[model samples]
Target chain A: MRLSNLADYAVVTMSAAARHCGGGRTSAAELAAETGLPVPTVQKVVSKLSAAGLLRSVRGAGGGLQLARPAAAITLADIVEAVEGPIALTACIDGDECAVDHTCSVKPHWPAVNAALRGALAGIPLTQLSKAAPREPNPSGISA
Target chain B: MRLSNLADYAVVTMSAAARHCGGGRTSAAELAAETGLPVPTVQKVVSKLSAAGLLRSVRGAGGGLQLARPAAAITLADIVEAVEGPIALTACIDGDECAVDHTCSVKPHWPAVNAALRGALAGIPLTQLSKAAPREPNPSGISA
Candidate 1:
C-alpha cells in the first residue's frame, strides 16, 4: 500500500511549496532543488497540480507558482489525487478487470471502503505538513 | 493508491475461501477456479496467507485449506499486510529514502496518517467481502 514514487514526490513538492507560500511564488526548479527531486519530475507534478486546481501560476517577472488556495484548505488527498486520479484502491472499481467481477461480492462495497480511505487522507491539511516536528533531546549535547 | 495485484488477488482469494467455510475445506485449485485466478497465483497467495496465520492447511484425506479463524475475525488490513508488509504509504517510514527527511516536517505525522488508513481497512471484515450487494430494481420486472 505504498504511494507511487510520483505521488510521494508530489507530497514533498507540495510541502516545499506550502513552506514558500507566504513569502512569494516559487518556481518548479526551486521546488525540485528544495525537495531534491528531478527538474522534469517536479515540472510534471507542477503541471498536473495546476490542472487539478491545487496550484495557480503567474507569468512575467517575479511570477511563478503558488497554492491555488490557502494551505489549510488543501489536503493530502488533493495532492495525491492531483498526481494520481481518484483514489480507487482496486482496478475493478473502474472496469471488469477482475475475472470474477460478475460474481465478486467485494466489488459492491469498494466505493464505501474507498471513501473511508480517502477520508483519512482528507483529514490531513497541507498546513500540517509544513510544521516541523519537535526536536528530540540531545544526549550528546551536540547539534541535532 | 491502488492495491498491488497480489494484494488484490489476496482479497479475492480470501473472499472465495470465506464462502466455502461451512461447506468444507477448500484447496488452492478450488479457490483459483472460484476466484478466476491462476493456479500458481493462488498457491502463492495461499502460502503468504498461511504464513500470516490467516489460513491453515490440513493434511491427508479430505483435508485442505480453511481460515485459521472465523471470517468475521479477519480484516482487510490483515490480508494486505500479509502480502505487502506494513502499510506505510511512503518510503520515508522505514529508511531515509526521501531526500528531505533530515528536516522534513511531514515526516513526524506519517505514522498517524498510516494508522488512520490502516484503521479504515481494519474496519472491514472478511465476512463483508463474501456477502453480495443487494440486487438492483428490475424495471421490466424480470429476474435480476
Candidate 2:
C-alpha cells in the first residue's frame, strides 16, 4: 500500500551520488546537504545501500559512497528490495503451507500479480532517476 | 508487499459463493466451513463485500449472500480494492505526498508502474478464478 520511506530516500540519496559520480567518494554529510536530506537518515540510507551492494563505501578522509553498478543497470525494484524483502503480495502467493493455502483458488493468481508488479518496478532503470535533475524553484515560489 | 488477511478471506469466501452460484444463497457459516476460514472473519468479509456492492446480503433464516454482479464482470482488482482500498504497490503511486515528495525525480514514473500493475490485475476476471479453481490433491501427495 505504501513504499517505505527508506525506499524513497534510497532513490534520492542515490541521485545525489550520481551527480558526484566522477568526483571520487562523496561523504554522507555532503550528500545530505546536496539532497536536503536529514543527516542521520542519509547515513542510514548509505549504510543500507552499502550493505545491499548497491553502494560501496570508502574509509578515512576523502571517503564516502558511490554506486556499485551503473545507474542504468539498477532498477527501482532493486531499491525496493534493498529496503524491504522479496515482494509477497499475499501470504499464499509463495505456496507457503498454511491451512487454507491450497484450498483458496484465488491464491494461485497472486504470484502472477506479484510478478507483474515486480516487473513493472524493475522496468524503470535508475538512469531514469537522474534524467530529470532537481530544478531550483521559480521566483513565484513554485517548482520550475 | 502483502495482501491483508482480510482480502484473502474475502477472496476465499467469494470463491465459495461462486461455487454455489445457482444453488441459492449460502450462509457465512457454510462458507467458513467450505473454505476453512474463521467464522467471524467470514462474517466480516460478507459485510465488507456487501458494503462494496460486490455481494448482496440478506438477513434472517434461509438468507445469506449472492454476487451482486455476474462473475464475468468482476475482476480480482475489484475484490482487492474492496478489502484493501486501491492496489498501490507504493504510496507514491497513490499520489500521497510526504516531506520529501518534491525532491525525488523518480516519483512521476511510479504512477506508470502502478498503471501497468493495475492493468495486469484487471486482466484477471473472477470468472476465470472460478473456471480455473485449483483442484484437490490426490492421496499420492502430489498437487493435481
Candidate 3:
C-alpha cells in the first residue's frame, strides 16, 4: 500500500546520484546536501545501495561514489528493492505463512499481481527520474 | 514494498466473503473463522470495508453482511484503497512534501507511475481472487 520511508529515501538519493552521473562521482555529504537528507541517513542508504550494487563506492583519493550501472539501467523497483528487499506486496508470497494460507485462494494469484506491480516500477528508468520537470504547455501562451 | 497487514488481511477477508456470496449473507465472526483472522480484526476491517461501500451491512435478524457490489465488480485496488486510502506509493505524491521536493524531478512523474501501480491492482477482480487455484499441467503424468 505504501513504501517504507527508507525505500522512498532511496529513490530520492538515487535520483540525486544520477544527476551527478555525468560529472563523474559524488560523495554522501554532497548527495545528502543536495537531497536535504541527514548525513547519517544518506550514509545508511548509500551503504545499502552499495551492497545492492546500485551504487559503487570508490576508495582513496578522488574516489567517492558512483552508480554501478548506467542510470537508464536502474529503476524505481531496483531502488525500492535495494532498501526493502523484493517487490512482493504481501508476505505470504515469500513463504511466510499467513493465518489464512491453507485456505486462501488469493495467494496463488499473487505472483502475477506482484509481477505487474514490479513491471510498473521497472518501466520507470532512473534517467527519467533524474531530469527536471518539463514545463506544461500553455494553450493561452501564458507561463506560470 | 509490502502491504500493511490490514491491507493483506482485507484481501483474504474479502476473498472469504466472495465465497459466501451465493449463500446470501455472512457475519464478521464467520469471516474471521473462515479466514482464521481474529474476530476483532475482522470486525475492524469489515467496518472499513463497509464504510468504503465494498461491503453492505444488512440489518435485522436474518441479515448480516454481503458484498455491496458484485464480486467481479470489486477489484484489488478497490479493496486495497478501501483500507489503505489511495494507492500512491510515496507520501509526497499525496502532498506530503519530502525534503527534496524543491529539486526532485521524480515528483512530477509520480502520477503516471502511481496510475500504473493502481492499474495493476485494478486489473485483478475479487472474483478471480476468490477462485480456487487451477491444477498445474503435469507433463510426465506423475501424480505427487
For each of the candidates, what fraction of the native contacts does it recover?
0.55, 0.47, 0.69
* Tens digits of lDDT, candidate 2, B1-144: 566778877877787888777888888999888888789989999999999999999999889889898887888778888988877756755656656535666665555666666677777777777756443333233211
Model 1 chain B lDDT-worst window of ten: B135-144
Which candidate's lDDT is highest?
3
Please state every model's RMSD to the true fold in angstroms: 6.5, 6.6, 5.0
For model 3, the stretches where C-alpha displacement exceeds 4 angstroms are: A60-62, A134-144, B59-62, B99-101, B134-144
Off by over 4 Å in 1: A59-62, A100-102, A134-144, B59-62, B99-102, B134-144
Q: What DockQ, between 0 and 1, does each candidate earn?
A: 0.35, 0.31, 0.45
Candidate 2 has which clashing residue pairs, if any? none
What would the per-residue lDDT of candidate 3 be over residues A10-45, giving only the tens digit for each residue?
898899898888899899999989888899999999
The local lDDT score (0 to 100) that residue B76 gets in candidate 3 is 95
RMSD of 3: 5.0
Better of 1 and 2 by lDDT: 1
lDDT of 2 at B30: 91
Candidate 1 vs candidate 2: which has greater DockQ?
1
Over 4 Å off in model 2, which ranges?
A99-102, A133-144, B92-95, B132-144
